[model samples]
Every structure is written in structure tokens, then in C-alpha cells.
Target: MVTAVTDHTDHADHPGDDEGREGSGHARVEDDFVTDRKDVRKKDFDMKDFIKRDTGKKDAGKKDAGKVGVRSESRMFGLVRVEIDDYPEKPASGDDTDGTDGIGNKGRADGAAGADAADAADSGVSWDDGLIARRVSATAEGQARPVKEAVVDSRPPVVTPLAYDGSLRSRLDALRELVGLSRTRLDSRTLAEAGQVLDEATARRRLSGQHTVVAIAGATGSGKSQLFNALAGVAISETGVRRPTTAAPIACSWSDGAASLIDRLGIPGRLRRRPLQSAEAEAQLRGLVLVDLPDHDSAAVQHREQVDRILALVDAVIWVVDPEKYADAVLHERYLRPMAGHAEVTFVVLNQIDRLPGEAADQVLDDLRRLLDEDGIALGEYGEPGATVLSLSALTGDGVPELREVLGHFVAERGAAVRRISADVDAAAARLWPVYANRRQAGLTEEARDEFADRLADAVGATAAGEAAERAWRRNANRACGTPWLRLWRWYQDRREPPTGRLSVRTHADEEATARQRVEQAVRTVAEQAAGGLPTPWAQAVREAAVRGSQGLCEALDELAVRAGAPVGRPPRPGWWPVAVLAQAAMTILQAIGGLWLLGQVVGFMSPNLGVPVLLMVIGIVGGPGVDWACRLAARGPARRYGLEAERRLREAASGCGRARVLDPLASELLRYREVREQYLRVTGVGV
Candidate 1:
């Protein structure tokens, strides 16, 4: 039996909420529940007439129960729910009482019923029929199958790994930027090594991307040339025991495409040879450029140098050793230990293991493993990726196929070139980390800058200039507003030395020398403050920048101080000064008139009574002194303001000079150091 339910929601409660009835609104609710309330149509499906029932394996005397299956489908109209329950049992006879097969038309016989069942399986409701058929089939078999439910996944997608060439190119770009930014601040030799690494990486990438260059290197009498010949399947490199047989490097190519790569290794064209043609063996080793390098411990200096040069350029290295010299100190200490980080591209081959007897070969291999572990080389055992350590006798061909199979897979991966370049970049950046990276984020503080400016101001005598300005104002005020006889007496005294001459900014030889010393000390103090907690190279750069900037600093300060403090012509007089001068003139004239009248009285040329003249003389004497004192008192406030303004201008000029000469250059050097450090971090992939 099939049951169908269609839900019809009423919209009468929310009449104004028509937003849910639009196209965009319907899309918004698609992820949610089906809430459409208009134009919904319902139809029911009779699943019994179309689905097949299995009748072979029913239990004895047990009531049959229909399988339960629920399906919900979403449409534009509304949600439709379907369920199956209480399936009818099959009849005992082959032909039904109604003369029809359960899955076809009403009156069809066996052959026609088969055709009709095929037609019904192809109908529009086939998905429903298929699901019901599986349920009934499970029921007939008397098995309880767990119902499958939909699972909602909420996890975000995984981030893709970076591509090899892209990431390497980005690191190279960052390293270039780091070198450019660290020009005058870092060690020249370290930067040169970094540049060389970048150059080598670029040149390697320009060659064949399909090929892998594997170099076989070992000490004298290690049979590396024999292993090289075994892998090449030809006697390409001569192998005899004359202490050091292979005196130079030789290249063997499995394919002809590695000419450019071999040329880059500085190998002559005559030493390059193709392996013997065995199609199956050669096809597995295609695109392989195997290099036979000279003995690393040869008595000849050029042979050792040749080994070093070729080892530096190869994409991968196979260190071949005999059973006796597998733990040689020169090989372990100079090559294996130093290239420990390049373990992924390294292979340690214990050659001539056929020479050992019984379990002695196994014991020698175990001891070699111990020595490799001591040299910090990780072994690629138990499916972990590291250096590949194996035993083989190149002369007897005992384990050469295993080495050949490993090399075949290694060459086919075509990742050795990229890995070697990445390891090289990592090693170079690690070496430069001490010069580029520091724990503290050092900078110049505002207090230090302010104190530096204050020191410069003091060195130039700004405070003394301000005091002298105030005193000059008071003296000029006295000259303009004092009584005429007092003024004449002051002018006679001032004629010996002018006040303008005293206001000139003149430094004697000793004072100038002292000012220079003070400027140097202030510059040094600020440089030290800025350089604190920085790396040695950067700290030295900061100090050098400050010293270079302070070359003519003392002279600049002297010029600015003279310009700021020099008095222009005479001091400016206020409008009130003229009024005070007139008052003083009136008082002086009164004194003169009174003295003339008293003189007339004494000479008997005028009236004898002189009371008015005596009164006039007394008023003039008291009034003149009182007016002079009043003018002097009024000049104090403006004189103070003028002095402060002079001091302010001088202070500003001195501070500005100091900032330009010392502070700005130091800040720029610090900024350069910061930029270079950031680039270094990018190259190293630190904090990525």
C-alpha cells in the first residue's frame, strides 16, 4: 500500500506578508521548508499494481509485514510525502485468481506478462517501483536491512596544496627582494651566497623538467664507477684498482634529452654516452641522467674538486661505499652530515656486500645503518620517506636490479629537480637567519626624540638668548621714557658701548668646539637608543647612518642660532612709548621754566616773590621720577612676551635641524632593515 500526504498552509493570518510569494522569495525558502500555499495540486500513486513481489522464501506460519519506506520531494507548489505499508501477500498458485501478473495489465498470461512487466519498469514511476521491489525482495529473504538516512555535511572544503614551481618561484622572488633591501646593512659574503643559490635555481629550472640528474660519488676504491656502469648496462666508465680510477666526471644518459643538463654540469661531450639498448630495461630508466663522479678522497687535488663541483649540481646523490669504508669519517663528516636536510633526495648504497661471508654482510649493513643514524640521516624504512639505504654488489650484480627499480621510480616521478632546489633555498635562508631575524621590534621612542631636540636647543644657548632679549627690552624702554637730563646722562654713558653690539650672537673658539662636542654626543645617544635590541648588523647600520648624517651638523646649528638671535636695527617701540615720552618732555620743560623764574628772582629782573616757581620746581622734580618708574613697570609684561617668542623660534629651529640631520636618516635605515627582515621571513616560509 502507498500513502501520500500534501500539506496546504493557510495565508489568512499574514495578509500583508506577500514577500514569500515572489520568485526571489521562493528561492530564499528552497533551502528551508516548503511553505507555498497557493496553486498546489495533489495526486496519489497505487504502487501495488506496478511493483514486483518476491514469493520464494517465506517463513512457515508467520504473518508477512510490509517494509516501511519514506520519501519526501520538494516542488514549486508544496511538499509531498509518500510512504509504503502493509503489503499484500502473494497467492499460492502460479496464476492469480484475477488472471493477471502482479506487475502488469489485468489479463496478461506468462509471456505477455513478461513483456508488460518490462514496459512497466520503463514507465515514469520506475524509481518508486525499484525502491518497492528492493523492499519486498528483502522481506522475501527474511532479512532486516537498515534504512539509509540522508546525511548533511557541514565541513568546508580542504585547501589545495601549493604547486612546486609556483612556490619555488615565489621563494626566489622573496629572496631577491631580501637581498636588494639588505644591501648596505648585511654581510656581503652571505648575500653573495644567496644570490648564487638563486642563480643556480634559475639555471636548473631552465633545463629539462622531464629528467633527473643522479650522481654516484664515493671515496677511493669504493667501486662507485662499477655501480655507475651496472646501472648504465655498459662499461661506460673504466673501473680498475689504481687507488683512484675515475679521475674525472662522466655522464650516462638513458635518453637523449639531457644534453643541456649535462652541459650545465661542465662535462665534456666526449665523456657523455648512451646506455646499451635493452628496450624493457631502458624504457623503465628513461629520462635518467646518471653521472659518475671522481673519488672524494683522491690524492689528486683536481679530482676532489671535480667531485665537489658535480655533487653541488646534481638533482640527487647516490653515495656508494664498500663494506670496509661504509663508515668512513671523511664521507660521513664532510658530505653526509652536512647534507642531512637533503635526506629525501639522498641514497646510501652499501656496495661490494658480496665480499662479506655468511651473516657478516647483514652485520655490516646494520653497522652502516647505525653510522647513518649518527650522521643524522633518516632512513626510508617502514614506508616513511627519507634517505634510501640499501646493500648491493655492483661487480657481482647481486642487488643491482633492486637499485635499478628504485631509480626507475625515482626518475619517473620527475620531482627530484624541484625538491633539490627547495632544499637548497631552505639551507641558504637558514644560514642567513641570524643576520635578518631578531626577537625585539626596536624603534625610536617619542621621548628620545624630544630629549634629543632639547639637547640641541641647550647646545645653541637659546635660553641665554631669551634672557638677553628681555634685558635689552628693559634698557630700551628706559632710554625712551626717562627724564631728559637722566637720558642725556645715560646716552653719555652708553656712547662707550652700543646695546646692539651686545645682542650679537658671537661664539668664541672654545665655545664653538664645545658646541660641536655636544652635538656629537647627542647624536650618539639617540643612535644608541634607536639601535637597542636590534641584530648586530642592523644596529651597526643605524649607528653608521647617524654618523654619516651628522657630518656638518655643528655648522648648521651655528648658522641657525646666529639668524634666530640677531637683533634687527633697534627694538620696536609701542604707541604708548610716544605718550610717555611726551609726558617726560612736559615735565622737563616745567623744570626748566621753574629754574628760569627762580634765576630771575635771584637776579632781580622780575618780581621778588617766587612761590609759584618753587611750587613748579617741586612738582617737576617729583613728577619726572614718578613717570619714569611707571613706564619701566609697564614695559615688564611685553618684554617678557618678546623674550619668550625669541626663545620659541630659536628652539624650533634647533629641533628641526636635529631631526633633519640625525633622526630622519636613522629612521630610514631602520625602515630598510624592517623591510629586509620581512622579505627574509617570506623566503623562509616562517609563520606561514
Candidate 2:
């Protein structure tokens, strides 16, 4: 029982009608009369009619679209009830709503019509540029009562930012550090090459990255000059029958802002040129700087040298070969073979293909590929990344477009400079691999250090000094507590021998000389053990460190020996020594009295008792000996403890001196080698 209706208003009355409906694409819903739901009519306005009606009368409203204010009214009268949910446009100043509809909604026709035009003009947004509101909803009158949710359509596209790449810079920095650490330990020649790579990479990065330097090089009479002129679209480089027409390099820039890059190649300003004035046609080659190098096999030595120098500086190279000299041994062996690692930035062109008939060109190309393969250059075909090979004739202009297209793509990528520098780093690292990581690291071992300390202690005579101290202590104890007659007898017996009152710990000159020899030998032995299994250069470095540290070590050891072996005096006496001395004295007196009585009795000067004399003699004999024996037994333990303490002091002093002089320096050198090797591994990306 539902029906639909469409209303059309005259466009001539509203001068700003086009502006009101410019980017708001939905048609206006208006004029609803409430009635019973069974008899309701719902209708959707046709968009084609709305657009056609607007376009047909657009000229009448165009003049005043932004200037004049007009009214647009929509009215509906029916039994069906409809609700209009309109998002009114932002109104201009001094406009208000004046009318209300059946759904209790206020309507303002004049303000609504002029609001879009005023807001668009003020915000500088073109509604015709498709600025549509997000919410456009409507409700239809039907028994089912369908509802549409407010949603947005045709939002602007999102753009993602590119991530920065720092892998190349990081690797180059690591290589530079390794080179710095290896200056004294590694060969000068190998270090110089690594230094050159670092210098080149730094200088190339300082220039504009947008420009790529590509050189055209070949042997004499290869028509490389002709190819260069053809690619440049001008005859700037001299070409003739001369032996070496292009003695120096000539630079051709496709676009501007390449003067600094060309100067970095060492080309003079007079030899620089712009190929074409109009840049839009050669937009793909905007950053290409082409150079024509001298003949590599020229008879003139300087020309060949110039070619070699320029080739090393350029980012990429194109080797043009004629069919006659395509497989020259000098080109393959001297240049191409050595540069096999740089295949990603190389191009091989078979020039003068016009001379070869139909299938001959393809056959020669296949043969060139085979030669390059033998030279260890990968072919950039079948979707592999390698050197690009193609056939072209500079004279006939055959296959020039394909070469130009390939060159343009290569130039646009803007990665030739980075790739070439990275290849150079790889080559340098490969050359230095043997010096950095040929064998397992060897370090100073604990057993070697202990043996070194023991040797030094022996050289200083610590053991002999300890034994002398022990004997000195025991001899002093016997002298302090022995019986008076026995002491006199012992002193008289030692009159012919040297004095034993103090220990003789002083070392002789010959012994000192022998100790010096032992010190040197110990240092050498420890250094060898620490540097065992190391490379020759590192071993030499470790030995040098030990030698440098051992300069005044022998003198230092002599001084330490003197301090540790100082003369030892008598040990402190026990309190029982006095009592023992008094007992010995009393025993001597008793023995003297007994001897006198016996002499008197034997000589008949006085009457004597034999029992008393005999008993006195026996008591004196056993008591003095027993007291001396007890004191000697007590002195043994203290003497041994004192000797051990002296030994420990001397041993520790010798060990400390050896550690400071030899072992520490050797260990530092080994640590330095390990640090440099670690940086080399980082440069090569091993284990990381």
C-alpha cells in the first residue's frame, strides 16, 4: 500500500542552488504529511534527474554561487509519516531558522542555501573537489520500517613512511675501527688497502647520493668513444684514428646538481658538459653522470694509468667490446676477472653488432656470456641480480633504446654508489681474514704464570736464605744456654773457622749474573707459552710487549733479593734461659769442689770421703747436660716457624715483580688482539 513521489523545483529562483548541493551528493528529503501507516507511500529520488536538472540550469546560478543568498524549501503532504534527519551546513553570520515542520524540526531555507558557499570560500575548500560529509542518513515509510546507519565512505588514502637503512654505514664503521687497532700488529701494506677503502667510502658518501657516476671503458680501437658520444647524444669527446683519442676523462651530466659529483671524480670543469637542455624528456636519467675513459690498453702509459685511476673512482662501469676484440685476454684477466665481486654495478655491451649478420649477433652475445662466466662474472638474466649484457651498435643506432632504458632504470634506483662501496669493503675484509681469524685465540695460562714465579724465586735464592735462618736460630740458642766449660771448649774449637754469630745471606757477583740470565729466560719462556698457537704477527707483538716490560726487571729483582735476604739476628730468649744458666753454674761449682776434694785425698793433704765426691761428680755431669738438651728441643719449633715466614716474604716479592713486568704486559697484548679480532668479526657479520 506504499507509493513514492519526486519533486522538482525551479532552479532560476535560487541563484546559489549549485553551491548548496556541490559536494553533498545526497538529494534533499522534504515535505512530509503524517497519516495512517497502511496507506503510506515511500520514494527515493532519482540521482540522474537531480544531476541533469542541476547541470541544465547551472549557468543561471553560476554568477551568484558565492555572492547571493537564496532560499530552498521542500514540502511534503500525505497520510504516510516520514522523518527528515538532515545535518544542516554551518551557516553564515546573521542567519536564523524561521519555520517548523510536522516532526517538530526548525528549518531555515536562506541560511541553509548560503551556508556551504560561505564556509567553502572561507575554509579554502572546493566542494567540487569531492568533500563529502561523513553522516548522510534517511528513513523510509514502510510497514517493515527499514533504518540506515550513519557511516562514512570514500575516505582519503593512508600513506606509510619508509624505514631508514643503516647496515652499510655500521659495517663500514666497524671496519674502520679494526684498521685502527691493527696498525702496529698487522702488515703495513694490508692495512693501507683497508684504509683506502674507508677513505673512499667516506668521500663518496659526502657527495650527493642522487648522482651516479658511470664510466665507459674498453681497449684501444673498441669504439668506446663512439658509444659514449651516442649515449650522450653529442660528440663532446674527440674521436678519430689516433692511438688514444680520449686521453683524459670527459663527463656528461643528464641533469643539473652533479657538478660536485663530477669534480669528485677529478675531472676538470672544462671537460664537464650537459648533454641536453630539456630535462623532462630524459627524466629517468636525471641523476646520471656519464664519463668517457681513455683506452685501457693504449700504447701511451699515462692513458692506461688514467683509465685505471678513473675506473676505481666511478660508481659503475660499461665495458664496450667490438666483435673483433670481444674476448681480449687483457680485458678479461686484468680488469673483468679482478672485479668479479662488483658484478652488480657492471654492464657488458657487445658493440658493432651491425657488422655481424642476423644470427651472428646472438651467437657473439652467447660467446661473450661464456667468456664473462669464465671471468667469474654472473649474468644479469632470467631474473637474477648481476651484470647487464646486451648487444648494440653506436654507428647504426641499433639496440640503443634498450641500453638507454636499462641505464635509466639503473640510474633511477640510486643505489649504485652504495653497492660499489659495499663491494669494496667486502673485498678488503676477504683480504684481511687470515690475519684476523686464522686460528683459535691463545692466552696466558695459570700454570705458565706459576712456573715463571717459581723460577724468579729460585733465582733470588729464597730457599737457601730460609735454611740459613733456621741454622742461625739453633746455634744462637745453644750459645745462650750451654754449660760454661762446654761453651769455652766449642768457642776455642771454632777459632779457626769463620764467625757463626750471624748468618751470611749476601749474594756474590757471579750469582747475581747467573740470576739475570735466569730472569731473561723465564720471561722468554712465559711469553712463548702465552703466545702459542697465535699468528706470527700477533706472536711477535706479544714478545715485543714482554721485552718492553722486562727492560729493568733484573735490577729490580736484585734489589728485592737484598731486602728479603737481610741478616737474621738471634730469636727472643725464653724466661727459663736464666734459670737454666744458674743451674749450669751451680753444677760447675759442685764439679769443681768434688775435683779439689779428690785431688786433696789423692795427694794425702787432707782426709777425704770417696762417696761424697763421687756422688757430687755424677749429679753435676747429668744436670748440666739435661738442662742444655731441654733448651735445644724447645728452640726447634720456633726456628722452623721463623724460617717459613722468611721464605714466604721472599717468594711473594719475587712473584709480584714478575707479574708486574712480564705476565701483565703479555696479557694486555693478548687482550688487544682479541678486541681487534672481535671488530673484524663484526665487520664480516659473523655470529651477529
TM-score of each: 0.65, 0.65
Candidate 2 versus the native: TM-score? 0.65
Mind giving the per-residue lDDT tens digits that candidate 2 earns over 1-688? 1122222221212323434444344444333332323333233433235335544655643443333223322332212222232323433333333543211223335554465454334333332112112111223443443333323333332322212148777778889899888887887897987898888887787777777899999988888888887886655567788777777887887754565677777876446655533344368677788999888998989888888888888999999998999999999999999899899999999998989988999999999999999999988898798999999999888988789889999999888988898888877888887777636648877888889998988888788777777777777778876777788999888886865543443436678888889888988999888878787788899999999988999888878877876354566666777877788778877888888888889999979789888778777877778778887898888778767777778888899999998888898888988888788877876733
Ten residues in a row with the worst lDDT in model 2? 128-137
lDDT of 1: 0.71
**Candidate 2 runs further than 4 Å off:** 1-165, 179-190, 234-241, 276-281, 322-329, 353-385, 391-399, 433-438, 477-490, 499-507, 533-538, 566-568, 571-637
Cα shift from native, residue 42, model 2 (Å): 61
Per-residue lDDT of 45-107 in model 1, one digit per residue for the tens?
222221212112223212322222121222322332222222233323323223322112123
Summed backbone clashes in each candidate are 0, 4
lDDT of each: 0.71, 0.71
Tell me the lDDT of candidate 2: 0.71
